[model samples]
Target: MPIVARANLSPASREEHLARLESATLEYPLDVLVIGGGATGAGAAFDAASRGLDVGLVEAGDLASGTSSRSSKLIHGGLRYLQMLDFTLVAEALRERDLLLTRTAPHLVRPVSFVFPFARKVIDRVFIGSGVALYDTLQSLGRRRAVPLHRHLLHDKLMTVFPALDGSKLAGAVEYHDAQVDDARLVMMLARSAALHDAAIATYTRVIDYVREDGRVIGVKARDEETGHEFVIHAREIILATGVWTQEQQEIAEAETGLRVLASKGIHITVPKDRIPAKAATGIITQTEKSVLFLIPSDEYWIIGTTDTPWTEDVAHPAATAADIEYVLDHANEILASDLTREDVIGVYAGLRPLLQPVSKGEKAASASTKVSREHTVMTIEPGLTAVAGGKLTTYRVMAEDVVDHAIRDSFPDRPSLTASLPIVGAQGYRELTAQRSEIARIREYDLVRVDRLLGRYGALLPEVMALIDTDPSLGEPLEGDERYLRAEVVYAVRAEGARHVADVLMRRTRSDYEVADRGAGAAAEVAALMAPELGWDAEREALEAETYRAHIAARLAGEQARDDASAAAALADAPEVPRRA
Candidate 1:
C-alpha cells in the first residue's frame, strides 16, 4: 500500500465537504453526485473517487443509518437464493463475498462457519447437499477459494457439536463457511475511504428537489438537516442508491420511470451468547414456513432473526412488534432443545429490504416479498439520472460499479472500478497489528481484552484511538454503564467518524444500541458530553442531544411492546427528532 493521503471526516472536514458541494458550478460541477448514504451509495462514492473522478455524496442521515445498518450482518451468498434457482445472484454475491473475505476488507470481514441442519435423512440431505456443493462450486469459479468446502456430519456427530439442537427430528447436518462484518462500520469506512480519494462526503444533508435544465438532471436542491438551511449541489450526473426508499426518491425526483421497489420488513433479536450456546453451535440455519431461519453469531450475542413480511407503514421507523417477536421465537424454538423466550431477548431491531418487484426473464411477478428476486437492477431514471435498487450487503460494491459505470460511461472519462484492488483505510496493515495485539496492549499498559476489542473494531487505526488515551487517561475508562464500549470510542466517533447525533454514535458507530442491555440509555448523556467539545456544542445542546436519544430509545422499547405494526408505529409518533443545531 503506497502512501495515499487520508482525511478524517470530523466536523471541520464535513463543513469543508459541504462548502465544496454548495460552491459547485454546472460548468465545473462534480463528475458524479451520489444520493443516499447506505452501503451502495457509499460504495458508489468510493467507486467514483477511486476512478480518479471528482464526486460528491450526500446522505439524509448518518452513514449506514438505514437498511445498511440493519442487516443480518452476513457477507455470504444467500444460500436460500440457490434454492430459488437464482444462481446468477448467488454466484455474483459469492464472488463479492470471497473478495471481501480475502482481499478488500480482511480486517472488517472474517470467515464464519454455518450449520445447515437437515430435517430428513434421504430427501433433505440429497437436495441440500447438491445446493451446498453448487454454492462451493460458484465460489471456486469466480475467485480463489476463500473458505473451506462444505462437509457432511451424521446425526450423532452433529448432536455432539450442537447439543441445543433437538436431535429427535434431525437427520444430519452440513457445515459451510461464510463471512460477516460490522455493517454500519463498513459504511463509515467506505465514506472515509471515498474522502481519502477526494470525494466530498456529506451526511444529514437531504435532497429536497432536483436541479434540472432542459431535459437532463443537472444538480439537486438539498437541505442541511442540522441547520434547516437549503442549498444547491450541482453535478454532471446524479445517481440514486437509496435502499428501501428508492421508490420515494424516484417519485420525489419526478423521474416517472425507474425502479418499483417493495419494502419488506425483517427483524432481528439479540440474546446473550450463553443463553443460546451460540459459541458452541457457531451459526445455525433451518427452513421456516415463511423464510429460511438463521442464528447469526457475534462476539457476545446470538442475533436470531428475521421475518419476511410486507411493510406499508412509515419507512423510517420500522419496529419489531410483539407478534413479530413471537413469530421469530416460535420458529426458532421449533428446533431448539431448550426454548428461548421473550425474557431472553435483550435487544431487538427491524429493517426493510428493498426487494425489486420487476418481472424478470424467467421469473413470475412474485406475489410475496420472499418470492421476489434479490438480484439488483441499474437503469437510467432520466437522461442524466441513474437509480439502482435490489441487492444484498455482500454485492454493494458490484452495484456501485454498475450504477456509476452506467452514469459515467457516456458522459465522463473511462476508468474502471479500483475498489476490488484498493483496501479501505483500516485494512492495509491489519494482520500485522492483530499479530502484535498483545504487544500493543503491553506498550499502552491497557488490558489485553481491551486492546483485542479495539483491534477488532478499528483494525490498523487502533493507534489513532489509543492516542486519545495518552492525552486524557480518563478517556480509557469504560463508558458509564456499558463497559464493552470505552469513552474514548465515543469521542473517537465524533472526531473521526461523522457522528452528528448521539444516536449516530450509539447505534451505528458502536453496537451499543443492540449489544447493550439498556440500549445505551445509561451512557447517552456521557457520550453526548464527550462529543460536545469535538462538535462545539454548548451544555444545553449536549443535554438536548442526549435527551433526544433517550426519547428515541423509549419509543423503540414501547413499540416492541405492541402486538401489531400499526400500534408499533403509533408508539413512535412522539419519538424525539434531532433539533436544529443553531
Candidate 2:
C-alpha cells in the first residue's frame, strides 16, 4: 500500500471527521457509536472500524483531555496486583504491554525500568523478588517481548547504579522492566488509528440525551461542546467508555444498569529530576497503614503522590487536598536525605479511577480506589447500549475488542474481531523506516537526534513531518523555550494529530507542559501564531489562545506555591477565562 500523508487532525482534519460522520448519517444504522474520546473509546473505535463496521466516536472535551491524559503513563503488568494474588489481571496486562511495546503501537510505547528500594531484609526481599520474577515470566510468555528480565542488586551495587541514593538503611534494590508512554499521545494515536480504518472521530462533542424507542436505546442527541449545535446520531449499537462518569451516563440512558462505578481521586505531583537524589529509575511502593504510595519517574521529572481517597464532590475536575500533598512528601522524605519542599514542585494533576461494583459483599465498600478491580466489566444495559467500566490503561485494546465482540454476538451476529491481526496507523514498516533515518536526516538537512526523535514518536510517519519542514525550511527549527521540539512538531500536531488547542499541543502532543520549567509559556504565542492560518483564527482568537495558555501556566505555577487546594484554586485567579468556541 502507498504511504498515507500525515494524519491531518487540525480543524481541516476535524472537518474531515465531521464529513465522515455526515456521510455515515446518510448510510444509516452505524454498527457502533462510542461515547468518550478516552483510551477505551478510541480503542473501541479502532476495533469496530477495522472490522468493516461503521463507527462514530464523540468526546466532550479534547481527545485524551480527561483521565486518559492524567495517567501515571505506565504500560505494564500490575506488580502490586500480584501481591493480592490477582494472576488474571497480571497476565492480561502483560500481553497488552507486549502488543503495545512491539507490534500494535510501538511508536507510542517503550520499555522503562524501575528500581524498588528494599527496606527490609527477610520476607519482603523474597516476596518482592518473587513478584518481579513472575512479572518477567509473564512478559516472556506473551507473543512479543515487552521488556527485559528483572535483575537483583546488592546494596553497594545499587549505590553504584544510583550514586545519589541515601545509603542509610538501604538493603539493596530490584531492577525490573515495565514500559512508559506519553499517555495523551497514545490516546490520540488510537483515535487516529481508528480514523485510518474509516472511523468517524470528533472531539468537543457532548451527549445531551439518549434516543429511545420502544424501551430501547437507538440513538443519541449530542451538542458540539464548542459550537453548541445539536445533532442526532442514530446507531444500532452505543458503547459507553466514559470512566468515572459511568454512573452519570447510565442515568442519562435511564437503563436499569446494575453496574455501579465509583470514583476515587488520585493526585500526582511533578518535581524536577534533580529534586530526587536517586537516578536509576527509582519507584518506591510503601506499605502504608491503609495503602501504598508510588514515586515513579516521568521523562523529565519524578511523579510522586497518588492518594486513593474516596471522592464525593465534582467529577469533572477533582481537586487534590493539602493532606494528599503532605502525605506524599512525608513518605518520600523517609527515603531521601535532603527532603523535598512544596517549592520544588513544578506540576500537579489529579484523575479519578472507575471502580466496578464487586459481586462479593464488602469488596466494593471495603476496597480503596487503588485496591479495587482494574478488570473491566461489559454489560448490555439496554437492547443497543453497552456500558464498559473498570479497566486499566494497559488493557484498553482487550477491553475494546471485548466490547465489540459483545455487540457482534448480540446485535450483528456475523462480524468477527479482526483487530488482533491488524496494525495501527504508524506501525507499517516502522523498522525499515528507521533503517532509512540517515537518508531522512540528509533529506531534511536536520540532525540525527532531531530526526530520530520524530521517527520514534511518529514512526513511519516521520517523512510526513519532514515533508512539511522541507516546504518551509523554517519549520525545521526547534520550538522556543522547549528547544527539544521542532517547530514542524506543532504544525504536525495540529495538521496530522487532531490537536484543537494550545493545551492539546503542549500537554498531549509534545509534553512541553510536563517537561519544561515554565510549562510551555515561552512557546505558546509562537505556536498559536503558526496555527492561526489553518484554524482560521483572527487576532481575537489568537490572543485568546495565548492568554488562555499563559493563564494555565500561571495557575500551575501558583498552585505549586499554595499549601492547600483552596489556595491552589485561588492561585488560578489570574488564569484567563477560556472563551467558549464551537
Candidate 3:
C-alpha cells in the first residue's frame, strides 16, 4: 500500500481552516463546498479532495454531533430492509460494509456476529433463513470477504452458546455477520483525511444563508457558533449532507430543492455488558406495538433500543422520554430471562432519521418509521447547490460519492472519485501494527491489552498517541475515573483530533460519556484541564467547560425521566449553552 499524505486535525489546523473560510471569495471560488460535517459531509470533502479538487467543509457543531454520532453504530447491510423486499438497498449497503471492513477502515470496522433468535417455528424458519441466505449471497458478490456466512442453530445449541437466553420461548436461532463501528470516530477520521488532502474543514461554523447570484448559489454566509464571527464562503459547487436538517437548509436558500425529509426519532439505551448476558452481539426481531427492537452489543456495553416514531420537535436535541425507555425495556424483556428495569440503564440517547418524503400523489405515509425506505436521493437545488438525504450510516461513503459526482458533473467533467481505493487516515498499515502489538506494548512499557485497545481506536496511528505519552509520562496513566481510556487519549484528542470542547473529547472522541455509569462526570474536570492549554482557555474558561458538560449530563438524565417528548425536550433545555464570543 502507498503511504498517503496526512495532516494533523489539531487546533492549529482548525485555525487555518477558519482562516481559509474567512478569506473565501467569488473570484477565488473553491471547487466544492460541503455543508454538514457529519459522516457524509466529511466523506464528500475527502472524496472531492482526493480527486484533486479544492474542497471546503463546514459544520455547525462537532463532527458527528448530530445523527451520525447517535447511530446504532452498526455498519451492516440493513437486514430488515430485505424483509421489505428492498434487495437493491441491501446490496449497496453490504458492498459499502465490506469496503469499510476490508479496504477503507479495517481498524474501525470489524465483523460482529449477530444471533437472531426466532420464537415462531415453521414460518419464521423458512422466511428468515432465506433472507439471511440472500444476505450472504450479496456479500459474496463483493470483492472482499468481510465475515463468515450465516448458519442456523438449533434451540439446544443456541442455549449452549447463549446461556443467558431463555430458550423456552425460542424455537431456534440464525446467526449472521454484520459490522460495528465507532460512528463518530469514523466521521472525524474522514474529516482528518480530507484535511490531509488539503480540504479546508471547520466545525462550529454554521451556514446562516446561501450566497446567491442570479438565483444560483455560489457560496454561503456562515457564522462561527463559538466565536460569533460571520463570513461568506465562496465555492463553485455546494453539496448539502445535512441529514435531518436538509429541509431547513433548503428553507434558508429560499428555493424549492424538490426534496422533503421527515424526521423520525430513534432512541437507544446503554447498559453494562453483563446486564444483557450475551457472548456475541445478540438480537431478536420481535414485533413491538409500534416497531421492531434490536439489542446490539458494543464494547463493554449492550446497546438496546430504538423506538421509531415521528419527531416534529427540535431536531438538534431529540430527547429519549420515559415512554421511549419503557418501550425498549418492555420489548427487550420479552425475550430475556431477566427483565431489565430503568435502573439497569446507564445512558440514554436519541437521534432523528431523515426519511425522504414520498412524492407520488395518494402515497400515504406509514405511521411506522420502519416502513420508510433507507434509500437516498440527490437533487440539484440550483445551478451550484446540490443536496442528498435519507441514507443510512453504512452507505455514507457511497452517498458522498454520489453527491460529489453530481455536484461536479458540469465543472470537473473528467475527474472521477478516488475514495473507492483510498484508505482512511489510520487504516493504512493497521494490520501490520496489530500483528506486532505485543512487541510494541513491551517497548512502550504497557500491557498487551492496552496496546490492543489503542490499536483498535487509532490503528497505525498508535505511535502518534504514544508520542504524547513519551513527552508526558503521566499521560500513560489511566484516566482518573475511566480505566478503559488513558490520560494520553484525552490530550491527543485536543492536540491531534481537533477536539475544542470538553464534550467533544469525552462524548465523541472517547465513549466515556456512555460506557461508564457516571456518563463522564467523574472525569470531566480532568479532561477539561488537559484541553485548556491547547484551546487557550483560562482557569475560568476551563471551569465553565467542565460545568457546562456536567449540566448537559444532568439535563440528559432529566430528559430520560420525562414522560413524553415535549417534557423531555423541556428537561433537556435545562442544560446551559456553551458561551460564544461576542
Winner by lDDT: 1
The lDDT, on a scale of 0 to 1, for candidate 3 is 0.86
lDDT of candidate 1 over 193-254, digit per residue (tens)? 99988899999999989988999899999998888989998899899999888878888889
lDDT to native, each model: 0.88, 0.78, 0.86
| Worst ten in a row by lDDT for model 2 | 1-10
Model 3, residue 255: displacement in angstroms?
A: 0.9
Model 3 quality (TM-score): 0.96
TM-score of each: 0.96, 0.92, 0.96
Per-residue accuracy of model 2 over 1-582 as CA lDDT, tens digit each: 122542446576676666655445524767799999999999999889888888889988888887888878788788888888888899999888887777887877877777777877766689788888888887777255657778898888888776656779688888888887878878888888887777778888889899888888888888876777788888889999998878888888887754788787777778888877564666555555555666776655888866677776557655555667777778778766678887786667767777875555345365555666779999888898988988899998999999888866866677877766677777787889988889978977778877667776888777788788879989888997789798888888888888778877887888777677677888888888887787788988998897798887777665655666566555554463244563
True-structure lDDT of candidate 2: 0.78
Pairs of colliding residues, candidate 1: none
Worst 10 residues of 1 by lDDT: 1-10
lDDT of 3 by residue, 74-161 (tens): 8989888877889899999999999899899998998888777887888888888888899999889836667998899988888876
Global Cα RMSD, each model: 2.3, 3.0, 2.1
